[model samples]
Target: MPLVRSAHERGITTLTLDSPANRNALSAGLVGELTDALTRCGEDDSVRAVVLTHTGNTFSAGADLRNPPPPEALVALLRRIVTLDRPVVARITGHVRAGGLGLLGACDIAAASRDASFAFSEVRIGVAPAVISLTVLPRTDPRAVARYYLTGERFDAYEAARIGLLTVCGADVDAALAPVLDGLRRSSAQGLAETKRLLTAKVLEAFDRDATDLSALSARLFSSAQAREGMTAFLERRDPAWVL
Candidate 1:
């Protein structure tokens, strides 16, 4: 079965993260599938926009601890979303953590339900949100990024929106997305693509400038002794030795 599922409505293509069993973790396979799906959307002139969503209570639980994609793959996936010709929007009604927040940041717009929560979970796992910073840091408030990235504490949708991590949040996420989708539907494909290019130029520049160093940083941290212990403790459901 595919980890990512694709569906189309009118001029919009909706790509859903479907690995609920693992909270839609970004395994290599899932990343590849989603990349391919977006490539298809980019090539199809009929596709005016794309909606990225999920199938479980958690939109994504960051990297798949047991089968995480290489940091480069994650970086490529994020860049794909940023540069895809059609506008990419995130429709989230669940929790997002770590690398998942990268997806939210790459999108041209993101809407979430009021109950949705977010966190930068890498710190707890003895890693930095290095690769994701390409999309995240450029879009979110620097002070807010400092707090969440260092503390790994969860924040609600309202806070996410306030800090520029989300475009909107409401009691009903789909209803909140209605006008946004309607606007996309009414837009000329060429106009949407050109405008999106303008909006995402800075993000793409960041990708070009920092992706290599960040991916290397990610690989180094994930292989370190501290990271091993942290990931082990996470998997074993116990506090790591350094935890007080």
Candidate 2:
């Protein structure tokens, strides 16, 4: 079965992260499938926009700890979203953590339900949110990024929106997304594509400038002794040795 599922309605294509047994974690398989889906959407002129969503209580539980994609692959997937011709929007009603926030940041717009939560969880895992910073740092408020990135503290959907990690949040995410989708459906394909290009230029610039270093940083950290202990403790459902 596909890790990512694609569906189309009117001018919008929806790509759902469907690996619910893992809370839609971005494993190599899932990343490759999603990248291919977006490529197809970009090639189809009928696709005016794309809605990136998921099928579980967690939008993404960060990278798949047991089967994480290569950091370079994650960087490429993020760049693909930013550079895709059609506008990419995130419709989230679940928790997002670690690299999952990068996916949210890459979207041209993101809407979440009040029940949704977010965290920069890499720190707790003895790694930095390095590769993800390409999309995240450019879009979110610096101070907010500092606080969450350093502390690995969870924040609500409202706080996410306030910090620019999300475009909007409401009691009903679908209802909040209705107008946004309607706007996309009404937009000319060329108009949306060109507009998205303008909006994402800075993000693309960051990718070009920092992706290599960040990917390397990610690889190095994930292989270190500290990260090993952290991952082990996580899998064991216990606090890591560093936890106070």
Candidate 3:
């Protein structure tokens, strides 16, 4: 029940993640509810654009390890974001880590507050970003993925936008997002769908052949003794022994 509220009005549909205590981590139910809401928005012609945001200080901390979604849910989550016809905007503030990074990358437009920071933290958690990596890395420059993935460093909003992971970064995030949504409202839904499809096709074409390579890397990363030691150290609030 990590997803707390879903509402639509005046051509904008907003879905909010409710697990603020855990920094709005993604739970199984959250994924299902979010997927369902996004699907509903896609089918409803009245919906002009989708806004994915959260209610707490942190936009999303990432997928909850205690309640991980199944592989099917993970696949559906990626496909829903990838195939959605309307423009989707991710509104980020505070700390967005791990799978939250994925959600940002999956959206058509991402606007973050100046205070917002993001990270790909799966490496430290002893797991691959997996489904998240699929959408997240493609939206960003491929070369930086290895550095961020291996280092698990937290990056600020400006750096995110500079690297192409985020589209917009500013203090007035909601204000910045307003005009973008208005522009989307002016476009024909069919045209948006076609554009999304063509663009997605082109992006996928580049990475399709390397799917196995990424997966192998993730598997090895997750299984490494260093991953386990690092994750344990993080959870225990101690310096990782694996660090130089």
TM-score per prediction, in order, is 0.99, 0.99, 0.87
Worst 10 residues of 3 by lDDT: 202-211
User: What lDDT does each candidate get?
Assistant: 0.93, 0.93, 0.77
lDDT for model 2 comes to 0.93
In model 2, the Cα lDDT at residue 194 comes to 84
By TM-score, the better pick of 1 and 3 is 1
Candidate 3 ranges beyond 4 A from true positions: 203-231
Error of 3 at 4 (Å): 3.8
RMSD of each: 0.7, 0.7, 2.6
Across 133-163, the per-residue lDDT of candidate 1 in tens digits comes to 9999989999988999999999999999999
Candidate 1 has which clashing residue pairs, if any?
none
**Least accurate stretch of 10 residues (summed lDDT) in model 1?**
235-244
